[model samples]
Target: MISKFCKEVRQEIFFTWIMWGVVILGIVGVSAASGFEHTVTGAYARGSVRWLLGMDLYSEGMHGFLYLPHAAIFYSPFAVMPAWLGEPLWRVLMIGSFAYGIYALAGELEKRYVANLFTVSSLVALPMVLDSARNGQMTLLLTGLMLLATRDLLRKEYGFMTVWLVLGFALKPLIVVMFMLIGGVYARTMLRLAIGLVVMFVLPMLMASPSYVLAQYVGFIGKSSVATDPYELLYSRFCDVFGMLRAWGMPVNGELQTLVRIFVALAVWGVCYCGRRMWGHHLGACLILTFSICYLMLFNPRTEINTYSMLSVVLGIYVGWAIILNKQTIIGGCLIAFAVMIAFSYEVVHQLTPGREYWLPPLLTCVFTGYVLFLMVFDIRPVVKVDRVSPTQSDMLGVDAEKEAEGLVMTSSVS
Candidate 1:
């Protein structure tokens, strides 16, 4: 009864690998053909060279390097190579890890949710993913690491999760939002996080003088602070919630926006504390990651179109799961529509009026966040079949084994 498309998509693992392998080769081939002068690889390469020279990594005169000193260490191997080899290698790392992360996460979801998700979500999110890959953006790498880390967190492997989280810190300071949200749910995570960050901060001293490394760390703080400030950004248009609001004539003050972000952070913390008990770990991880990525797009001052790749991956997977489960058809349809919008946002942005380039991505992210919040606030046990909860999950969720075996939904109310 299965069609050719369904059979191909359902071919477990090798088929997905073949698909992403083609994607990686295609995108990396383009970057290799075109010199990477216009891509963000320059910033990463420059920082690596500066570290080798014992120079300041975050020099004010030479901008575009907002990452921590650890980032230089991470990229130094590629930086030291010839441009021809190094650029393609870096893209390989970005796109390869991204594809692998999706495969790993999709495998886990298929085991749990019983859906054909890998290719569907990847193809749905490909437009944004391709944009990030072509530009050599760290969002690809960070999203990859976070996707792996999300699996570890759901498995209760805090130590492994902390390792991935700290690696993300070396790329962008905004990763702190995810760290904070995860730390809120797993209180013991803060201890592991503190230890991991210490290791990241101290690891660079081995390459350069301790004093030089320490100074770069200090410079990283000042540089990242400025990098996050909207006033420091060169352009007026942003691809965030505020940008959409400004385009819609509902401008909010910067200070007020900070307060709004803070409020959302607190609300996410509450979700972490309470949402786990209401739903199983499967949906809890979904909500945590969804809220984290949505916040980054809707709240961060410097969000770009490429950053939507991170959001797209998470949303795409959830959309596929919703439709496959056949429990929330309406929300699933909305998510599919938005996924189409995001995939076409780049083509559509240029046709709109100036300064409105920031409109669709964040507006779509805001709508996505609303659906995530709805799932968190309302009881979601009905969405998952009762028999799917493993014994350990039932114990952790405090569900009656006999009742769950009888297909009775857990009636736990959200506090």
Candidate 2:
């Protein structure tokens, strides 16, 4: 048994190393090209770190007036470093942390080739690398923390798990919902997380000035209302429900958007609930679907194309699972294609339609939304449950049944 396990580990490690090499090579190739553009917001985030923190140089411009001052505080450390030093180092660190986190998460559940797939898939697109490098956004970091927290929680590493959850919540407060769900399942850990959040978020606010916290938060929300197409504005794709609506000349009045919000929120909660009940092959699918759907439905209507680059991680999880489980039936392939289209529409908006068309993004986003709903309602489940069967009988079910189960296992392993 020990020898067999070691053999499997060696094979998996070989695949992982190959995948990592390919991705790193791709990233280096892209960076070498002169045509590569940095995102304006990313540039701003990097520059603003100095201005907000009064660290290096005096800042200029109206950009600071729009956001919660507190938000900028997070980036001060990165900003203090010169761009020459900061850019490559920051990007490498984020990519490395994300890869490590992915490896750790996959290992916790004993999934094969997670690190390799994550590294390879993330490298397939230009937008994904740009999102991490340009803005120094917390996407990779947040994802890493979430993955780590999930793994730790599963292992009942309550204290350490809570620490990661708190850090995740600090990075993006919305992830608190996910932490809450995990906490609910593990009551003792949840208490530690809740206390930790109060201390973390509160300490920052208290350190800044009591009014600054509410002011920055309120300021961020207010600024967010003046929505820009992340694709058009940032030169990336915009794929979310709002993208379609805005393109179609539909009113984006937040007050009127309540129904959509409520519907999406409920759907997300439902996915989380289902994730809680599943295990083994079903577990990863449940978690990935829950995270992706919730991310798209609840957080992404106002998202920009560059932001959609982050979704590839979730998509990779699904795809990886599909390969191992042999699950993407002809029908499943079509559905996967549709989901990819929706995701890509936002990430690479230029290919789907001409910029003259405003409605394309929103339309694609809505279609993606509907696609998720369809999968949730009808598509993302077992075709048939396996009953008790002799080992010999189960093994002899022929290619069709064996392939189907394999696909299910792949899908179930990550999400």
Q: What tens-digit string does per-residue lDDT give for candidate 2 at 120-188?
A: 333332334454444445666666777777677666677887788777665555455567566544456
lDDT winner among the candidates?
1
Q: What would the per-residue lDDT of candidate 1 be over residues 1-415, giving only the tens digit for each residue?
A: 2244345556745677788878888877787777665489898889888888888888673257888888887899999999888888888899888887777777666555445677767766776788788888888899888888887876788898898899998776778888988887767789999989888888878777898888887898787677666555424567888878877787777677778878978987787667776675666666677778888988888887778888878766876766665456786678777877786786787687654777898888877777666756665442455665556555544456677788864431111
Q: Which candidate is the best by TM-score?
A: 1
Q: What lDDT does the true structure give each of the candidates?
A: 0.75, 0.51
- Give residue 342's lDDT in candidate 2 (0 to 100): 41
How well does candidate 2 match the true structure in TM-score terms? 0.68
**Runs off by more than 4 Å, candidate 1:** 1-12, 61-63, 233-235, 327-330, 381-415
- 95 Cα displacement, candidate 1 (Å): 1.0
Worst 10 residues of 2 by lDDT: 56-65
